[model samples]
Target: MNPQHTRAFAKAAGRFSNTDRIDAVMLARFGALMTPQIRPIRSDIIRFANWSPPDER
Candidate 1:
């Protein structure tokens, strides 16, 4: 799904305010329900550096 459309849907669903915390929650919900494809990192170092649970991040 397009980011624009996702934002629009979130707005319609009463996410009127945009903030880092709120965006993270919204994206987490979206990812859980939508299960978007995750592209693998080309390098193990890069992946390891970036890897963390959402809560940890």
Candidate 2:
């Protein structure tokens, strides 16, 4: 998984320790609470949605 959002969450939490254990806990909390979207898969859905007719959409 990309660490981008995890890092962002850490920053948002005002964390600066950068320890592996702390990062792991932070990532777990981020995953559980935020449940960030999966990206490339979402792109495919967006493309289909955009191409669909207004009624279908």
Clash number by candidate, in order: 0, 0
User: How well does each candidate superpose onto the true structure, as a TM-score?
Assistant: 0.50, 0.54
Using lDDT as the measure, which candidate wins?
A: 2
* lDDT of candidate 1 over 1-57, digit per residue (tens): 468756876787698457988887777777777787777666977989889878864
lDDT, each prediction = 0.75, 0.79
Tens-digit lDDT track for model 2 on 12-49?
Answer: 89884669888888888888998877757678788887
CA lDDT for candidate 2: 0.79
Which ten-residue region of model 1 has the weakest summed lDDT? Answer: 1-10
Tell me the spans in candidate 1 whose CA falls farther than 4 Å from its real position.
Answer: 39-57
Q: Please state the error at residue 29 of candidate 1 in Å.
A: 0.5
What is candidate 2's CA lDDT for residue 5? 70
